[model samples]
Target chain A: MGIISKGEWIAKDIQYRIFEQPGKFDQILSSERQLSVEYEVSRNTIRNAITILENREIIQRDGKEYRLLPTKEDFETLEIMGKQSWRTQNNVVLDTSFETNKVQSQELMQPLGTNVRKVSYIRTLADSNTPIGIETAVLPTKALDDETVANLHYQSILLFVGKQFSEAFSEEYQQVNLEHADEKMAQLLKVHRGEVVVDRHSLFVSKDNSIFVELKSSILPRFSVIVQPDQDINTKVDGFVE
Target chain B: MNNEFKAPLYIQIESLIENKIVGQEYLPGERLPGERELASTYGVNRMTVKRAINNLVSRGFLIRKQGSGTYVKSHGVGDKYYFDLAFTNEQSNAGISELLAKNGIKVSNQILGREMIVRSHFLAKKLGLSADDEIFGLHRVRNIDNEPFAVEYNYLPGSLFANAMEIDFQTIGLYDYMNSKGAQPRHVYQRIQTLRAMEKEATLLQVDKGDWLYLIQYQSADQEGRLVEYTESFLNPEKVNLKFTVVKPSI
Candidate 1:
């Protein structure tokens, strides 16, 4: 590949510096103006340098200046996607919270309703410490009562349910759509009043008894989600004997 | 051009300059042509160019000073995108074709392929089709920006369209053609997901294997509630952006 542009290199440096300082982005970037003046360079070069940092989410623009935010959940997601490439990994992040309450059932859709209540803990990707996507779970009421569920570090609810109940998942139904981040979610996402986020809502059903598991992945448009084709054929091989 | 089709002359001039700046034709901090020169180039009145420059000044794309002429803004940044409801006007079959043409992507009939397959067990379950019924399978590749972005596989009952195969697939959108043939859709059930692009997918899309791909499947129905269209598209996540709105059902 071609050499990294000077503008891009400067941007990465700013991003590292901002992430390290956290909330001191404006101070660091504004200081670069002095350096530009000394080097006899136009302020445009400094601006280009800062633009790179903003795009990386290491710093965010706040009116005429920029700010730094740090997020733990967002870091972990990037760590996984970073395996793809440095550029692909630097997508935008939104942080937010969501609540699902049980209501009357409808013809087309319904909320999770089970006597053995289950509450899934999920996290979404974040940039500069903002929530972009989240994952929540629903289990029988009894599942939430587990001590492990109460105090755990990022519990994989699917794995927990599968091992405990011998429940093998059969097929998953996913609904991908877009929606405006709600006020509460928008605040958590750290976005403007009505920014758009991609919504990936999925329903996983158990093969044995047809139990359904729902998952939602809300994200900024920058990142892409990939899934392999589902090839689960529920047939008995022994029955094919001629 | 019609008055409605043409933007205000000043607005047009303003946008033209903005596009040049954003397109990097005029780099940041580059000096724009003088007012007299620009007026002669665009064949617009000088006052129109001045108004356009003033608008650009307020829009943060240009800077003006007492002695110096107009200069492109150096700090032009932050292209904010907010998600909202899908706008029908933003969507057009012809626009897609035009973009593809501009990108030099070509489409061929590819042997006029067709297949009669069993109703998808999945679709039969979603659309209430009979388990044993057969549906027409029509598959095609849509090119975008000089590369294939999607491989569409559509399944519909043969009875739905009398000459589904005979319809023009190149010049018109399949959905629009269906509507014009009296199969106007009222609502559709859509399922979207992301999947790893496999070898077959990679070859078809001209993308590397294991690239990220988005899959969208839809079952559309008419006003009378008859199932009319079932389409599944595997697309490049980079080429197209999906936008829609979801609202809570009123109690």
Candidate 2:
């Protein structure tokens, strides 16, 4: 990564200050001279910094005063993704229904077990009750108890299983494809037949290197997936899959 | 007969042709043998060869040119460009524009509209906001040189971006504006899928109906886990190539 210039840094700091005081955002700030004096920077640097913000429309000139514009709320520190210390889990079940079936496909199982549970569900948004996507997860019955299986309806099955079995896991493989909605998918997604949709297939491996779950999700149009590879990895996968 | 492996003949034929293409035995922009010739070569019927060819065509590996034989579809590598998914900075777009400019491509945005909308159920969930909350909706057509390349729709909570509707997005990028507000995105979750252009998208993108498009959905959150913005982009598959890097664990 490249370092940002001094002017850019100063601009970001000023913007952060403005965002911190949301109640005072609309209020006119000090004069340019006063700002330059307070920041202990040269008048030219202050002017350059202010220009950066002005171009972004974070602030507008009101006569001789600069007024902060309405913008997103600020935080003291922004999280770096690859180095995230903590993750906020979305565990709330908005509104969804699930159906359980016996696993019949050998590819869905790890060792061709018969007691695998295949759960299919349609996840919907809370406010409008619009279906977001359809997900099907296959897991070994021995890995989860009856209570855990029941709770999968309200919580993410992957999270629940991870908590119960191992401390960490990674997706082994993921494949994405574009296809038209079939009759059943159209009904579930509330779209007409032949509507374009996205299909995602993932395999999750536990800490012990055992494949515990295989999940397939079909997302409606307007949703996308992004994957960032670790910098240390040798092989890089890029571009649209199909 | 290989009774143990009951794979259909058409599927096997499809893979055979697919291998040839993947292995570069049949190069892109090169014509393939006719159905009858393929059928005789593979010891399959003409109908099976036709079915296999149709499957590959639908998969974007082949193209049928009118008044000409089917040819291996060019992957459009020369015309396509790669957008970095890992970079989190103000210059990401600037860098892309500069790179494209080096290739004699001018990138510009056509601002479609900017308005305040009540948060829908889907938008509320994605942005972690309540229904009925006001949000800024910014729509733009991303043009490559003078041609439309993609159409983008971005939604930001109005509480955070109070005067967003008044700002001119054509002059500055949205991410640049957000960065100026100290709300720069540090991490993004993205999903890439394929869909056919509908009537409205077709008109906006200057493509025919049912044209395959690459749909990229992105949600960016601040370091504090607060959702900042949700964007959905419809890209012309022929013009854009979405890329990713999947890393395997060292262990």
Candidate 3:
């Protein structure tokens, strides 16, 4: 994978337009005359690049005109598992409870012998009082100041923690599964006892290699979970164990 | 009337029919039982059955042919919902075709064309190459069990894969060829999104207009961080389910 030549680069640029913004250009630089003028490349270079793109099926020669190929839709729905900020969507919080306790080894990658703040709450749909989900969030107490922790009543704790720490943190790990609701969970979710539910667990890690928060959510069967990984980061986990 | 039931009779009837359609009890373009027959089967009035049928028709599940009976609408290929939770590590190195083959699924490729080209500005920046550098481009359509599922476009550095243009991609997997060339990809970056089929895509994929597709852009590099290949693949969403796991590094 050494350095590529200029013609290949231009060829890729044209291909990107077809995929990222299809049909924007009726036909990519319809003629060799337009290609040389727009791309500021020699005739030979433009011809080579266009041939490359043609070979890739990014563009096709329709008679005399070269038309860009149609691809899939461009719009994207992104859902970052753990790093997403908690916001109410047509749902009202029924109750909230906060407590402070020693950090458990299971909760953090390595217990720092420090206390953590735990926030738990239940939410229901606005139209009907039917429960939707329950969330439990745990954050290191030492990482935040007293003011930030006090204001965590009904706001997004991830945002609050982000503002407190200078280093950036992102969702590092997430696991989603279907599980039967226990008696207490069923009571909160208003579902039949032992009904199937969506359970998700996530861990957010800071840039400096600290697991700052752990979140667990149990959602009713009516809801669907969408997880979109961050594209910019190299999120490939080696030896991925389910 | 049973007051304990949460849903009304008409709504429950609608769901029953819808489930049958989804479960393939009634196939696409298959005519459904008459409204009177449905009413007697459900012990409901003709109006209730009519309403249930109307609901499905409006939702695109059923269609009423003029002067004929109601029929399940043909949703084209890949209508059945099947999801695959694909692990990136396994997919990136092994290639999707090989992965599917291992699962007892037949994978085939139709090579559209191959040619040598000079780098464009975007490709130059992406592959860390000079604008004038030569590269090889390959276009192909990938199918499973003889059904077209994905269209693939691949770009490889000519300096490393000068003989790429000579290989017959229709019979040989691209990754296998790369591995043979001692350029097996070690790292990969990918972006996945849901997209609607454009006209050309719809025709190539044999899907109707506006069918949902899974678009995956993949870039891979060797151990030394030299860009090996970049690919854009459009997949039929209905036939595939993608799943990946992310883990935090130990401190």
Candidate 4:
């Protein structure tokens, strides 16, 4: 690309801000005024830049405030793949060998509503020969009724539920956090009390609205999240040793 | 607004200034408000403002001299990140060189090999060159703290980057100079994978042969959507980590 023209540069900056800070337009300068000032350029230049963002569905001008347009499900899927790749690159691991004391039915709050069922296989992921994540996945008996689903291993849960039984798994949601591992979790992961670790609770669902599986991956806190707008990523793989 | 993660303060400050430029609050060629004034306005120390402005200067965002006041520099073709790091170094104690510095990484460049060969059918299509046309192959190793972290091999159509042989392998960022010469990167695509390091890579990264590594191959294109640069980054499994944020529908 040639040198960025004053107008184009201004536009790119606005687009980046809108993506980075979802709803700061009111407190910050509008893309329009910003373009006029910096480039000694026209408001239309800013509008054109914003138009491109609108086309991508990153943001929508709502009354006076520009609201962020939520990304489609593919973003989360790609994001997980990236994180898993990074952790593998870093060689951090989670030990998933902790045995379960009991397998019982329990009720938990879910987005769709309250659901009750037996959850199984509390697992952990490890890196550098140390555990970094602990996961206790709950599955509704109805969802796991088939013998095939029941016999599946931890690694094949998403695949069996997604590709084989239900519709193709294409959507995911995740909450990332940095905090100390709780006592129980700390014991399972074998980390010191109050040590910071990366926590990512992710859920994958099918187009038919079935909850395929949930994965909770943890890592050492030195990692970060880098979000780039307008990129498409497919497939998911998790590992510690690259 | 800076994303409220515990990112370094200097990065936050730099982004703030970048925002002002984007907002047109600081127009091109226009002098920024005085350091004291900006410090007071931003509620930061004057030294902080100095650092920020110095970074802008190195980034081609601002121009300065010993006696004369600072002014915005016009965008010129050159390594943008190189100048960016130069300016960033002026402000914060660590500077933009933080990426490599924090990891205690040092780079040693060796032109492993170079050759002129005909472009393959696949490569020819990507570079807009004839399938049988000649291109230069440049291979180099990047070391971190005396250990190799990545080996890069590049293919360039000889017609482009003709003075390619003159590149000071030990110094200078390729893209920065290309940008100055009017080569800018407008888009990039990348694919990442996890694999075991081979004997050659194991020797370079100083790890066992069976150890793992992250492989990233990326292609960058110009504004006209023409392919310009292709790169491969092989990361040592022990030293580096990657981060990516995924967004999707709420369902």
Candidate 5:
């Protein structure tokens, strides 16, 4: 979270661009020559920053180009959520980075101590760069392929699942509630401990009613989020009140 | 209808009857099936059905006719109806009033102001009208058990809904007025995000300055695709749930 070195700040700036303007930001990082001119820094400084970004997994060198890796951003996937026009697509969260681990979760409705893949990230508002929340997605390893788990850091998780395992999930459940951010949540979201935030829990269910993945998000309560159920809304009543 | 988000039996019943009314399956002023009959239809206890009907009545979505039967109110469109009024059954969205009510919570609205005014350039663009055009503006607060949770500023174009401000918004719902004018919304686009409250907004919502609240922005069009309404609502995140249930795709 601290940025005392020049190379690190340049790396942070590059990170901000990809997260904020994903559509225009090509996955390939600018060449060292191009970056030095654009940032008005020497080639060594640009190279150092590129190295730092590479180490942070923000970008991966594919031959000569550094391809920007996908952060845990909701808008990274366009097939499932968001509007046709990017202007109205609502997930305005810019994530700094995401980390993953394997842990046994009793919460997943699976066997007593089944190992699950958990992905955690800090979410900042794209426009403001203000840390607004944290999100954790715990996946029950029993139901997913190992390939999907391996690509978690390199690709958009939601997008990958939609492309590969869309048929496996047919129903989703989400609930939003309010709670004060605890110490760990505050540290991750970059807010004061005890500040009020909106906590959301989501579960995706398989066709056979088995749990697939559970996602938990805690965000500062500064914006409204519009959502609707995709089925069985039962809007048939047609009369108006006098 | 995932099990994890499944509501209680009473809420399901409430949703059923409310859906019928909103779907126009039940006409205005028409009597609803008796509690006993509904209980049997939904396969639940009559007391539970009674609770559902009573909740709708208290919210002015329905009324009791003494010896006759429970009937749909005809004066104004209830908040629940706004959901159906704005979208087709298959793509329908639930309003905040219905969401809170489903949880067995009581919600009420207070109209702070209503007036006809010249539209600003911003309003003009949003409503797809000229800046000089006059429009009806309504300001209101929604309270949950008398605790203020949202402040809404809604606008309606004068071209489509003439003399709309003449109707008392406090006594009649906006959808009711829209329905009478043949301007029932058929399509709506909404976006939700958060904003820090200022002094005036904080005082209105009874929250501290700089506290974050949900800012919902909506633009709805009628059957002809004419923009009829644009609204901005600031809501307290404490009482609302942002639920998204994905339905099983039909084979």
Candidate 6:
């Protein structure tokens, strides 16, 4: 959660690589030339990263080659994980608004006539200001505390809830499909009507399966849903019986 | 599977329709015959037919309109899954063929081409090989029930898998082949994204040009921590559903 420089991020990536490919990756750490080629970084950057690693005792200077040592498991999430981890990415929200109403009919995992809050926003790149995605989030009104409900403006609902309830949060069951751009979506996304867009629907549920949040996103073709099936879940389900 | 005695006629009729749906005899969104017609077809009474239809509707296999009767519910091509080909027999990384066969669906693959070539600069950087090293490229299209849904290309180090030029890819999975050579793909890094299909891809996947495709790119490392393979697979989204269940790592 701390802001890290590029060299620090690369250092964390090197540590993760060593853990992932435990016995073999240490050989790459033997020399600066090998480390630079292995990570596709400049020799100077690799030098900076190696100094950080050595100071942390992740690796030690031996007679000819570096020796691997024990260190705490601390790594950058986005650098180690290829393709953006949707939940962890720093999304800049733009043109956000909120509306509250009572549910008229039965909702997914919600009973009829529950009070709910809805927010619609466009996500933009901080540097480019180009619209990348549009998202709509809906949640029960009671899920929020008074401070969050009172000061609601343009903010990320996921980040808000994630900061508050980090322990119980488990994200990411996603369904990706294609949808034609509607008039409102076309104007917001700057795409012609009827053009194809990637539609993603996701759910963030609690580990105890109590709280649930539904997120629906419409993104340009530049974005795609990444799925790395958890081996633990695969074993638990035993090949998805349903 | 406890069948001590004969169940009721309606329940048996319910399972009969269920099997037909699962077996793909009655396709998704295809209407079932009317109750009167079905009762006569099965030599049953109208009430019995009505009960069977009612059971299927509640079980989510069939939908009933006011006047149109019942139709098979479409669960997006109904289990014609283009699943992960990264398989190991011991770990149960089940491939497409095993999964489809488990569901009683037929699976087949057509080998497009399998050739050996010298490594390029890109391959050398990724696989950590010297220039002029040999690499194997295998191309195939995966079909379920004779309908093509996925097109794939797998690249492997020929120095490690010299028999790649001779092994029949249709008979064994790419990961299984690697395991047979004493190398196990124990760690993998994959990226999933969407792309618009171009002319060649559109034709191969049977989708119109500009249609969206699910592009999956993977690099796998063997048990010895040597990067062994890189695969690129394009799947027609309409024909297959990619469902993901992700567990969040604690920060």
What's each prediction's clash count? 22, 13, 26, 29, 27, 0
Q: Is the docking of candidate 6 incorrect, acceptable, medium or high quality?
A: incorrect
Please, what are the lDDT tens digits per residue for candidate 2 over residues B1-251?
A: 66557678999999889877875446555578889999999999999999999999999999887755787776744445444444443234233344444333468988887777662544555576876898787888888867888888888888888889778888777877886776766556565545567655688899997787876666676555566787778888666644332333346
Which number leads on TM-score?
A: 6
- Give the residue spans of candidate 6 off by over 4 A: A1-116, A126-129, A145-155, A223-242, B1-54, B57-72, B75-91, B128-133, B182-186, B222-226, B248-251
Instruction: Summarize candidate 6's per-residue lDDT along A1-242 as a digit string, tens digits.
Output: 11223465577667655755668855657678877887787999888787666644567678766787643211112212322223222233432334432222223344446555666666655456666668777766667654664333323455566555556765555556777899988888788898777776666677775566677778776543454543422333222111
What is the RMSD of candidate 5?
A: 15.9
Writing each residue's lDDT as its tens digit, candidate 1 over B50-119 gives 9999999999898775565677765524211111112111133222333333223333322224555552
The TM-scores of all predictions, comma-separated, are: 0.38, 0.39, 0.46, 0.38, 0.55, 0.59
Scored against the native two-chain complex, candidate 1 gets a DockQ of 0.04
Stretches of candidate 2 off by over 4 Å are A1-242, B1-78, B89-105, B246-251
- Rank list by lDDT: 6, 3, 2, 5, 1, 4
Every candidate's DockQ is: 0.04, 0.08, 0.08, 0.03, 0.17, 0.18
Off by over 4 Å in 5: A1-132, A140-143, A166-171, A206-211, A220-242, B1-107, B244-251
Between prediction 3 and prediction 5, the one with superior DockQ is 5
lDDT head-to-head 1 vs 3, winner: 3
Candidate 3 residues lying further than 4 Å off, grouped into runs, are: A1-242, B1-92, B249-251
lDDT of 1 by residue, A1-242 (tens): 11223454355445545544545655667766774774355677677766645543345677766666332122222222222112111121222223333331111123434343334333432234434354455543444455646432333444445445433454444445555678866776567756666675544545544354454566654443332211111021111100
Q: How close is candidate 3 to the true structure, as a TM-score?
A: 0.46
Worst 10 residues of 2 chain B by lDDT: B87-96
Q: Which one wins on lDDT?
A: 6
True contacts kept of each: 0.05, 0.14, 0.12, 0.01, 0.38, 0.35
The Cα local distance difference test for each model comes to: 0.51, 0.61, 0.62, 0.48, 0.60, 0.63
lDDT of 4 at B247: 28
Residue B110 lDDT, candidate 2, scale 0-100 = 88
